[model samples]
Target: MILKIFSNNYIINITKSLPRGVYRILPSEEFKKDDIVVFEIPEETKKYLFDRKYVPSIVTSMMKKVASEKIDDVIEINNNNELIINSKNWGKVYKYDSYGRKLPEIDVKKMKVQKGEIFLLSDYSDRSFDGRYFGVVPISSIKYKVELFFRF
Candidate 1:
């Protein structure tokens, strides 16, 4: 994963496969009338697997099994490059692995500031030791965004 921070916002590019079942991989740069950009994983990429044959088939099956779990949110890239996500609600944070034992209370709704560090949120809970547990991250730590190039 790469994150490029501009003057006001940031662009994130992911090189690795998304967290198992992320529906949207790369969002389109174009803007629709609704002022939202849609993202979809290419059908060819969706059906292609690296080495495992059954993996792709299984993933396809799981996709059908959990169709409702897909996310269809609107993302707006501002002039400053800041991504304005207009959707059902604000973002959510899951709990971290370590937090499972300590069980820290994280209030996602109250989280206002963007930390400088890479805070790993839990996949299940929000109250976990993420940036809140450690400290603020420095802007210099950010790198480049991931860019996926397609050849026609």
Candidate 2:
């Protein structure tokens, strides 16, 4: 579905089958482990996602549009300082060296997802730039929990 925010509209393709029960909860409600939600992506994360292509190397690649508002499937929530996300498409991850230049983090295998962080994953999991690349998100960023209903 294409949702417009501010002036930009974001297109999120919902493909999951709705479970047996469908309900909505108050914002004060606690989040479950596998809840699918819609949340506001921070400006920093939006910029990070936007500038991903031009970071370390300026490759003239065709850039796809990413939005600050996301409909994500929650993976792990705040427990320590980590959130393990499973976004569909992985992007170029940049980490600063001692010199402060943009460089790829080189170690996706050893990278650890921490607690107290709100990491999000794309349901597609094959073409998303999710929490793994952007690191953990804050718990306060989540907006609502939603359920999908497919009528076929």
Residue runs of model 1 more than 4 Å from their true location after superposition? 1-105, 114-137, 149-152
Error of 1 at 145 (Å): 1.7
lDDT of each: 0.27, 0.40
User: How much is 18 displaced in model 1, in angstroms?
Assistant: 2.6
1-152: candidate 1 lDDT, tens digit per residue:
22334542433332221222123223343222222111222234335331324233433211111001112323333444222344322123233333253322333234333432222212222332223232222223322222223211
For model 1, state the Cα shift of residue 33 in Å: 18
Best by TM-score: 2
Count clashing residue pairs per candidate. Answer: 9, 14
Instruction: Write the residue-wise lDDT of candidate 2 on 1-152 in tens digits.
Output: 21323233222332231222323322444555456655556666556645654232321111112211233433432334233345333232334433565543323344443444454554333334455455445556665555433222
Distance from true location, Cα of 103 in model 1, Å: 5.8
Q: lDDT score of model 2? A: 0.40
Write down the worst ten-residue block by lDDT for model 1.
61-70
* Residue-level error in angstroms, candidate 1, position 5: 21
